[model samples]
Target: MALMQSKSKILIAGGGIAGLATALTLHRLGLKSITVLEQANSLRLTGACLTIWDNGWRALDAMGVGDTLRREHTQLQRIDTLSTTSGLTKCIDLQHHEMRLVQRKKLLVALAQALPSNTIRFGLKISAIHQRQDRSSIVTLEDGTQISPKVIIGCDGVNSTVAKWLGFGPPNLAGRSVFQGLGNFPQGHHFQPKTLEIWGNGITAAFGPCNETDVFWYLSRKSLSSDAEISYNSTILQEKARHLAEDLGNKEMVEVIKRSTPNSLSLTSMKYRYLWPFIAGKAQKGNVTVVGDAMHPMTPELGQGGALALEDSVTLGKCLAEVDLEKPAEIEAALKKYVEHRKGRAFEIGVQSSVSGILQSGSWWLPKLIRDKVVFNRLSPKMLHHTGYDCGPLQILS
Candidate 1:
């Protein structure tokens, strides 16, 4: 194949939630020449569901997909927590918060559909990244084609190669692993639209309704083995998830795990980066920068992974919209503004999520006490406070 020099003004890696949203945000800003490179042949739609809060919806709405999504997923009304060891149950009302359990596929499709059909190029892998003195970047695809773009945004997720080239360390293992899947009850699930959580004995399992027939569920516990040792086979993952659900003695959750489609089951280690590096280190180098999990991978205990990425897309787009991308210095400055705006917010949420993960998986008595007594009631208010933050609306740049 001949060397294809990309004429696009901006190139985004990973085409996942963060990448798609960023491209959509820029498109909404009347910005053109944005190209998104997705490493997969198509969208990866098998992951567990996302719990998008009001802040996420705000960003989605700004991107013009909020109402489209709200129509598909049920709005969660409350959180019901049960302790397997203590046999205690608590309810946290969420009638006021606009939260929904969204299927990952649906969200990605919505974002992807909103953009121009040619915006995303799938099945192309980046083999190398070279930074230029002018702050532009040359991205080499595995096929040997080279594309030099004025700005490169890395939303490639936790194992982001763009982030690695930017000098970021690997994401730290949270010392815990998660087994998650979607359960389908073709007839009807009949459960109220609420989040049901159960914890104790170093395990946390939660499930919420995506619709009347589809339920998203997950079980998290202290890591039983190293990240590499964890099995990726769907059958093995399903078997382990079912076993854990049985041990928790939740017959309903057990049934959910059993009912899960084999393809939907996944087992992986939870990883996050410390806030120090983001604060003290560089989030951007030249015209290249990272966003979403590439920038701040946090535990799902806070359920902010998807939401935070949505927040990052809007923030980054807004920053770039105000700059004159023709100037390399201006492009770098725009990235710097985005990094500065997001690092502090990302750090705050990252700390809370890490602490929540620790409390959820800690087998020690003191941690258990706090998880049961302090976390349940206080968790909602804290979550609401964070989710209430608005990333502001996008503007159309001339």
Candidate 2:
């Protein structure tokens, strides 16, 4: 079978946050020829929830979907941390910055709803891509169909085939792994609208409410066991997470973990690309470019993964809007400008998130001392500084 629309002006790989956001941004700019290719049969909502900060909301506002999402969850006003060893507690006020914990499915649905119908083609996997003599790229699908597009954006995520084809190195493991899931309270849990974190030896745990009835949580540990060792069973993983919380003496979190279903549970090691690729290599080749985790994959310490991807959409949208896609040279130039503007910022955030992962997941005395004594006292302010970034507006050139 052949694809009815064999060609597109703009093609985006991956229908997750990055791909959808890029498509929505272009739609907001009045571009009608954008197409998003998702490898999954339906939307991939594996990650149960996401923490969208102020910067992410700004990008959402630019795409005209911020207010719609804001109506679903309350704004988190503070972050509370507990050190298990010293039994010391710290609180950071977030009265100035906006933060919310939202269901991942809802976010994906919202982005998809805002776009034109058929803009996303599900289950179309790209097997290979090569540049044509005319500067366009020819993408070969898994079933042997080929589609040529004037512009190609790789938003396929950390294991991006597009990134590998562009000559980027593999992602590096951060010597730690994480378990994430969502817990439902049918009777309505009454927890305050604040993020709570527990810091234990080589382990960090956090949780917050997604709405009145559901809560999201995660556990990160320095020691990693192979998936086979952990049994690859959600029930077992959920039990393991509950056990870790029990060891940390968080009875509430243990209950939360027990209430979560197997479908919501996930476990994976943290991975990030070294800064050298961004410093020396090209994120944009010919009329092609990469966005979000496809370009820079960072640990979840800073909670900026989703936010940064949103920022990329707005930034890339602005760059592409300034040029005529019909001209291959113009498209290439626009992509280059987008890469120049984003590489430095993404690299800086990736490095900072790595540093934060070390501080939060370290078991040694030195890291614990610094974290409890110095870092906690000013954690929120420093976070505010990083999340305060503005990716500008989405506008097109005449």
Candidate 3:
């Protein structure tokens, strides 16, 4: 109905993991005027859980929340992979790394709590964004209220309107979909602190304990159609998952599915956008840019989606801290530095994830044989180590 002015200098869209983390990182760098807008009525408590590798922990440590997360999670010592088609199995030692499994909501809550009160505004969906010649952005909300902020960060996810407005197209689907659930064992279940995955023809399933009493699990398969519809009814989805697991013939996985509550099941399609053309072309238009899935959506083969988002938050914060935001040219230079530092790493991971997904999910004989004999047993550990990059420190200006 009327234009509203914001005192905040930076406006972040999509108050999910990346957006909230960005706000916290900026606040830690002594920038207090940060606003996070979320379309949801409140924080989303739905998603099952997330596995944070060493690199992700480093980001959390920079934010000062790593210790809090470690207290509630189950540390992983190893990862075991089993191929049903070839009847081969391999185990890779994680070796003193801080890999932990945490509930998604808990992680979000921890990030949100560290920020100043009222930093996030729920139910404020951004409708459009227009960047001025001087590198400031005018953001319009769905309610027709306009606010001009010094910078606009797009952490809105794969279907990001900010990305679209910045000239990045929708992500490409990986031709597969995933069903995930949280298996609750109120009385506690006997699962070792290790990640386990079973690969079958055209299907794969993974399960790992998040804590002493609860486990997080997922099943992925080729989509029935190009545009497969997701079933949201908990009972129906649970039944579908159970049947899929039973068909895979993994008794352990079946038991985990059965233990899960019907309401905790969720189905989502995988999508990603290649980072080369986007980065080589234009990642920042004036003062508006994107991060996390909005900028580099990739398949979850490496489980780095959330981790990379965390890294982006801290890295962007560091870059912005070195510049004078009041000067448009300085702001543009800082964004360029952010893109130069992040694009290569993010693109490498995206391409690796896409290739890994294709190989891991292949039903062909030769690919399966090579994957079982070479990839899992030999190459995977090295790949895991490659992702453990440090995003550097979040520096505060004096």
Candidate 4:
């Protein structure tokens, strides 16, 4: 049987954080004929956890889910950074803002639940995209079904097919990878409500309580050039993580790694694609655009990947709300503004994250000395505060 023909005012690809948040924000702005297509059979609960800072909380509050998330997450009071080489620890105050550690699954659930039933369609994958002269998109699904929506927003992640079709290239490897896991303590564990990071030769480890009984942790190291074959086996990855934790000399982190099951461990190579070249080289074509990892996939050093996705969703919704969808010129102009604003912000964050990963993973004596002696002590708080931007509420553009 052939798939039935359908149309929507807005089609959002990838029902992850960015897509779901976009749908919610648009609905709040009185635009409800939105459909989100997710390739996965169901919502993905795969990731370990996320560190949502003040900016993310502001976005969530604008979407009306801030209180809901606040009740579920463990609010962090401060961030503690340790240097194994110098045996020094530095604490940066969060100023009582909303810096939270939440399970990825919970965050996804909250975003999904806020939307109306039937807002998202699962197991539908887009294979190709064609933009019309009138600033709309004709999308071809993997099963050969076609959809023509007035607007197409790609939230499909780092390897987004929509982004590829829109002329943006694939994400670049940052020459580093991470192994992450969650440790569950049913009887509860004795750990302060803070985010802890430890850096040493060639490796970095971080852990924090996600809730009363669970702690999220990750270990990152430089990939062996670009030629080394990295193993993805669960047991081997777990073993590698255990050894890295041991090298960090943090008893709490080591114990957390040991307590985690092999199944909870996962490895991912970091990759990013800067947005400036796409904007400068080619004018954004038609009404097709991307958000979140699809647009700007950055290193996790700054923990702004997810937060930025939330920011994108709200901003995109506001921009689109300002125009009359019936007028192609107005719609095009609104999208241009959105792209101009997001591209600048994403590029800055991407560069900052890349540099931070390099400095944190530096093994050289001079770089390590500067990072430990000056950067961590004098500049850490300033860097952290820079991410505290408030994404304002969605509004009608005058």
lDDT of 1 by residue, 183-279 (tens): 9999999778898998869999999899888899999988875434545677778888898889888888888888898777778889998767788
Native-to-model Cα distance after best TM-score fit, residue 247 in candidate 3, in Å: 1.7
lDDT of 4 by residue, 291-356 (tens): 899888999998999999999888888899889877778777877888887887888888889888
Q: Give the Cα lDDT of each candidate.
A: 0.86, 0.87, 0.84, 0.82
lDDT of 2: 0.87
- Model 4 clash pairs? none
Comparing 1 with 4 on TM-score, the higher-scoring candidate is 1
Across residues 264-362, which tens digit of lDDT does each residue of candidate 2 receive?
888888889886767675688898889999999999999999999999999999998888988999999999899888888998899889988888888
The TM-scores of all predictions, comma-separated, are: 0.95, 0.96, 0.95, 0.93
Q: How well does candidate 1 match the true structure in TM-score terms?
A: 0.95
Q: Give per-residue CA lDDT, model 3, range 1-398, as digits (tens).
A: 23226487788999999999888898989885788999998998787877788889999989888899898898988889888877888887788677777788889999999988888898898899877766678889998889887788999999998989988877888888888998989999889999898888888889999998888999988876632455667776777888989988878778888888766678888899967666684677888888899989999888888899999999889888888878878877888888788888888889888888888888878778778777866745766775569997666442
Residue 76 of model 2, lDDT score: 88
Candidate 3, pairs of clashing residues: none
The predictions' CA RMSDs to the true structure, in order, are 1.9, 1.9, 1.9, 2.7
- Tell how far residue 357 is off in model 1, in angstroms: 0.9
Off by over 4 Å in 2: 1-6, 228-231, 396-398
